[model samples]
Structures are given as structure tokens and as C-alpha cells.
Target: MAVTKAKKAPTEGAPVFFIMLRNMLIGLVSTVATTLMGAAAKGDWLIMLIYLRGKDGPDKALPSFLAPSTNGTAEHSVVDEFLEGYGMKHLHLFILMGVAGSFIIYYPVGGFWHWYYYVKRRDQAHEWKCQPNKFLTKENEAHAVMMGSFNMMLGGTLSGTIACYIVNGGYSRLYFSIWDYNIAYTVLSTMFVFMLNEFTVYWSHRIMHMPVLYKKIHKWHHRYIQPTAFTASAMHPFEFLLVQCLMAAPIFIFPLYAGSYVGVLLWTYYYGMKDHSGIIGESQWPWQQDVMFHDDHHLYFHVNFGMNTKFIDMMYGTVRKKDREYSEDIFYGFGREKTETKAQ
Candidate 1:
């Protein structure tokens, strides 16, 4: 419930412990739901959704997937036996999670919001858009959707597998009940993952805006001055690799739980989409510098380069002022806005 203004800061932020507590609560909810969704007990009749068995330790989790929803090939689908015979059934889970995260979460949510606020509630135009009339074309929309969808799936699959192997020691991380898993572990691990992810995106975003890199790599992402939901994840695969891949960095150092990792990325995908939707208004985690901050990044590229928090951008003196001017570049030519006429 806070809106930041330039380098000046919020009077105060919710305590760090409270943020960690909230992450723990989110982990608890998401873990239980994903655990059940991936759960299968022979003859539950829902076996069709999850034909394969679990892989992690008895009280652990895995990136497993739902069995094929088809009935063929000796009464079993090709996918059914392929995973079992290869002993890589967990691959199915990773692929399924990736596809679901990409299509289900990333696709429809942002699209719906854009239509909801922009089309249906057009009267709130000024309230919503930081840079009105600078819409993405059908071509840009299609490119963004296709590229973003593919990257979301790819990033999820790779990161899930890596995290699964490391966190579970090549096993699952599911427990029969919530009491079995330690809230301290889940909460601390989730907070680590969240903070690490923020650090990754903040630096990656600033690096992309460098002059030599901008025209070569990040320019395509800046095509839509007034981006919508579909444009949330739109970026060059190289850029996605630079920024999104860091979500897995915590796993290499910290012992992040498998379920906790998934929860963190789910937030990243969902919230990051909203961040790019170009909608400027009150949000649930306004203190996180959600909408206006990111919209300002797209509208006035010279400022607000940090993601999820403005601390880094403010420190770098890149936070945008209402009447900020974009005239020159310093280190790597990061400043490239309206010296003449920028995004309006």
C-alpha cells in the first residue's frame, strides 16, 4: 500500500521478519496444494491425471508429472511406458509443471487483466497506464506471447530439474502432513530464494540496458512503450537466460526445499507478469514496488531498472523523477530515452 517517488524512500517498510513469515505461509499453502495435485494412491480413480509414482524421499517432493490422459499402446500411452522404462518419470513432472506454469499462469492472467482494465474499464485509462497510446501491435503481441511462453516453459523445466536433484538429493520432498515439514525451514528457504531472485533480476535488468547490449539484445523487449499483460515476459531468450535463470541460483548455495522453490517461481511468474502489464494503480504488495515502478521502467527506460524493489535503482541514481530528463549515458550508455521525443 505504498507508492514510491524517485530516490526519496518510503517512511518505513514492513519488518523483514514479517516478510519472511508471509513467505512461509505462502510456502505452506502452495506446498500442500501442489502435494495433493501431484499425489496418487493406486486406484484413486484420479490415476489418469498422475499415472507415474513419486520419486523423492517418503517425506519429500519431486518435479513429477501427470500421466498421459490417453488410452492407447497396449492400453497405456507412449508417455506412460517411456518414462517408466527410462526411469526418468520425473522428467514428466518437470515438463508438466513447466507447461502448466507457462500456459495456465502466464498466458491467461495477464491477458484477462489487460482486457478487464483497459477495454472494459477504459475510463480508468489515465489511472492505469503510465504511457497511454503507446500500445503493442498484433505482431509485437504475438512475438511476446510466443517467446515469453517458450521461455517460461524452458526456464521452469531446467530450473525445476536442477533444484529437484540438489534439494531432494535426487529424491522427492513431500510429507504426509503439514506438521511433518518444518515451518522454519520452509520460511527461511523461501525468503532466501525470493531475495536471491530479486538480486538477480535487478542486476540483469540494468546490464541489459547498457548501450551496446540494448540495441543488440534488449531493444526488442522495449518495443512496446506501453506494454500489456502479454508483454510481461517478452524478452530475448538471451535476456531471459541472464535474468530468469538466477531463480535457480539459490539452490546451488542454499538448501532450498523442492516445494519452496516452486512456490517462489510461481510468484515470480505471476507477479512479474503484472509488473510488466503497464497498469499503474494500487496493488496488494505496493511496498514491493510492483506496478508504477516497472511501468516507469518501460515508459522512461533510463530509470527504475530494478525489479521488485527500488533500493538498488535508487542507489544507482536511476529512479525516475516526474520531470526527469534523459540526455546522456555514463558507464555503458544506460541512458537512452527522450532526448528528443521518448515514449509518450
Candidate 2:
């Protein structure tokens, strides 16, 4: 049976500030954990490859994460030089690591976020859910996870291939760390990357909504019309490619430091999950729109293709303001729902 809206219920427990804090921590920890896992997996794969070649340690200067030393000199795997250096010098190794790393990181991160919000917080689940009465049935949930997991793998492969190519081309500046560059460059580059991403995402997403593309490629994502944190990365391969292309587009123009690149990756994961989180919260900032932006896209299917930000959407006139009382969908079969409706 099609689910319908339930009666609005009162918000309980913590104040808006506390709820936001708790939710933000969950997201932050999840993203950082995923990134760390990816790094560990990448290192492991490189180690295996080196061991296969009868090498045990890196043969060259290492990145910041691996080169940390006490006396201002790069410290490295003194006993495992052959193991680390060969892969660092080879493009294929990076690509291999990237593919493995992506899967290792995203799948669990998505699942954990889903369980934390949807199952663990059962009492506040509906209140937080953006789309009421729109939970994925078991079959659909499985499909979403499967597709999302595949997309994460694909993203890893593509990103890894790109990293290999860039590093091999002798662009050392492209492989910098947060401390390698001055604060001004890091801050400015971060902002620029954000702007570039918004511009590309806004246009690519809007174009995909065209009927022909939507029917063939984007439909898989819309299956989770009421999106969960897991659904953020869940999408048709073509759609993931399209989005990742835009995301990686800036690399052609900018030589991003390693820390900056990691920062972008983390921010992408964070915002993507937050936007898909069904919960309503205090705006806090004038520029920050409620979840309704993307939530409406899933619920109504026609507007709000923008990401978390509205700069480009505002300029292009594609933003769709969600109805005040009807922002989220029904969570359970019961006739009542919890509303966090704030004055628009």
C-alpha cells in the first residue's frame, strides 16, 4: 500500500542545539573513520604488491602520513623499503589501491550511518526522517545497499587511476599535504574547490533530470525516494560517474595538496549524508537551507537538484522551496508523524 502523511507529533528530549551537535558528531566520526579505513586499505594493498616483488619497504621519500619524523627528516619503513617504493613509483599500484580502498571505506560507512539513524534511534526515527511513510522495504533496502556499494568501488577505481596519472606526471605540487602549503593556499583552495563542485554538480544534476537520462540512468537512485544516509552514495554507475567527473574536474586546473584533497573527500561524504538525512533541524545560518532541498527532489521528483548549497541553484532559478508542514514523509503506518517544522 502507498504510504500517506501521518499526524504531526511533538519533538522531545534535547534542544535543537544538542540534537544538531549529536547528529553532527555521528556524521563527522563516520566520515573520518571511513577515510582512515581507506588509507589503511591503500597502504595494505601497496604492501602486498611490494611483497610479491620480494621487496619489504618503501624506496623513496614518503607522503606526510608515512614520513612523520622527530628530527624534521622524513621517516620511512626502514625495514620495508622495497615494499613501499615500487608501488609509489608505479601507476597501476595506486589504481589498484584506490579501487580496494573505496570499497573498504564507503560500504561500511553507509551501513553504519543507516543503522545509527534509522534503527538505533527508533523513538526519534520518524521525527528525524525527512520523508515520512517512505521507508525502504527489505528488498529495496538490499538493492540500495548493493548499488551503493558498487558505486563506492567504482569511485575508488576512478579516483585511484587519476591519482596515479597525476603523480606519475611529476607534479609534486599536486601531492602536497596541509602543512606543505601555507594556510592561505589551503583555505583559498578549499573554497575554490567547493565553488567548482557546486557549479558542476548543479548543472550535471539538473541535466540528468531530463526525461531520457532520468529514465535510463538516474532512476536507480530515485528508488530510495525517501533517501537515507546510505542512499547518498547509492546510484546507477552512470550517475556516479557523472557526479564524480564533476567532482574530479577541478584537478585539471588546480594542484591540490593531499590534505586539501582529503578534506574535499571528507566534506563530500559529510554533506552528502547530511542532505540525505531525513531529520529537520535549526537553520543556524541564513545560507544553509533545510534538508528539504534534496529531500523534495526525492519526494516530489521534479526540483532541487542542487547539493547542500544554493548559490548556483539560486542563480539558475532551479531551487524548489518545500512546503512548510509537509517537508517530511510518513515513517510508520500509524496515523501520526513527528514534525520539526520551523518557520520558513
Candidate 3:
């Protein structure tokens, strides 16, 4: 007798790989363009000219304090002056790096885990089919990339420039070192920022979901019901600005000392990226689980609306209940029970 062969199950790994690769490419291109634009706006040409001229003209000359400060009248030392100048020249570069870094660190580790454990597994088992309506086409994917990239550049530039100015203007000590700063106070301040911004986001997001606004603004985002990383930042300009403002307002209103402020900004960006990721799983460590709560909401929208915690969603009963009944109805017609009894 001939032996029978078993067919292999189709794998979901390829689709996931392509999705991540495409999004990462888009992000890289966007970051490069934004960095170039930022560099041009910050008088980098002038800095280059000064470096080339070698003390021949006023524009070419370095500041006196940077030149050893013979009088030493509390002016910046040579090291300090160099650091100050370098910081100014490359501020935008650092901002771009910071944003990119967040994505890099979050995806391969946190995102991979979530995709493997939840999304990919579901896809393979055919238990979680992406609604046809939710699939992103090539055109929509391009739109999402453009929208998300532009918004990120705008937000990053605005916040980075403002923070740089604050730090350079005699507040350098505040933002220089996390260890030297009041850690407890910084943590508290950071948490406060998260809470305030969450409320702002909730209301703003809700408003955008309304019919009139949804068609004009929020629909672009909802277009990606099965969102990729690029989908995180994709939004209408107005909506993008609104969210950025909500994230920025607390920083401006209740300013942290410089070092603490830097910490807060970094933490905020990391959280923003994490919240948008599609992955959902806890790490070996307990605290790690808290990271994916917001992202979970975005993946399954009826629940997990709160940014920092599930408090609001739970209290309001917005938590998503698994629709076992709906699934059964889909598999077996709604009146199956009555029909089955009559047949019997």
C-alpha cells in the first residue's frame, strides 16, 4: 500500500515579516528626511562656516568663554562651552535618534513577543481572521506612512527645540543626570503627565470618532483596524496636533527640573510607542505587563481605552467581553435551536 502524505498548515510568519519590514522602511525614510530638515533649520550652515573660517572673521571666531576665558568671570569653561555648542548643533539629531530608538527597542522584543503569542498564533489557527474591511491596501498604507511620519516629525521637532532652549538657558543642571535628580519627584511628575494626557487623549479621540469628525479626521486611523506600527502615528493634521498638544501641555504647565524633564520626555515617547504596538504580553517580570495595556485597547477597541491604566474602562464597563454567543450564531444560524428541535 502507498503511504499517504499530510499537507502542511499555512504559516502566518511571512505576512507578519512583510508587515514589519515595510513599516520599518517607511519609518527610516521619514526619520532621515525629518533629520535633514531639522538640521537645515537650526543654522547648521552657519556653524559649518564658522568651523571652516578658522578665526578670520567675527562669524568664524569662537566665543571668548569657549576660548579659555582668561578673566574667568563665571563663564563656561572650554569643555562646557564645547558641550553647549555641540548640543545645540545636534539637538535635532538626538531627537530623531530618541524616537527611532524607542521603535527599535520596543518592536524586536516587546512587539515580537506579542505578535508571536497572540496575533500570529490566532492567525495560524484561523481563530482571529482580520475583518476584510480592516485590511490596509497599498494606497492606504502609503497615506498612513505619510500622515504618521509628518506628525512624528512635527511633534518631535516642537518638543525637542523647546526642551533644548529650556536646558541651555541656565537650566542645564536640571536635565543633565537622572541619578543626581530627585528620582521620587521625577517619577511622580512623570506619572502625573501620563494621567493628564490620558484624559485629554480619551476626550479628543472620542470627539474624533463622531460622524462629522470621523469622516474628516479619525477615519484615516480606523482604516487600519488591524494596525501596524506605522498606523500608530497616522492621523489627520488637526487630530495629530491635538494629541501632541495633550502630550505636551503637562510638560509646559508643571515643568520639571531640567534632568527630570528630560526623563519625563523620554518616558513619554517610549510609552507612546508601546501603546500603539499590536503586541500584548507580560514579561517574566511583573512590572513589564503594565506596558501593553494601552496597545491592547487599540487592537481590540471596545475596551482598554485608558492610557495609563484600565481603571476608567473597567469602571465604565467598556471592557470588551468575548462574544462567544455571536461566534456560535455565526457558525450556526440564529434560529438553529428551534429548527433543530422541530427536526428531532
**Top-TM-score candidate index:** 2
By lDDT, rank the candidates, best first: 2, 1, 3
Compared to the true structure, candidate 3 yields what TM-score?
A: 0.51
lDDT of 3 by residue, 1-344 (tens): 99997765554445888878888997676444333332222212122222233224321233342333444345335434555675443344435543453344333543453455345664453333333224457786678667766765565565444444443342222333445557887788666665676667666665565557766776667666555555666777677667656654554565444434434444444444444544333433332335346544444443445554455555655544453121111221121234454575
Quality of model 2 by C-alpha lDDT: 0.58
Give the clash total for candidate 1: 12
lDDT of each: 0.56, 0.58, 0.48
Please, what's the RMSD in Å of model 2? 12.1
Question: Model 2 residue 215 lDDT?
Answer: 74
RMSD of each: 11.6, 12.1, 13.1
Better of 1 and 2 by lDDT: 2
Backbone clashes, each candidate: 12, 16, 4
lDDT of 2 by residue, 307-338 (tens): 75765667765555443232223211111222
What is the TM-score of each predicted model, taking all chains together?
0.65, 0.66, 0.51
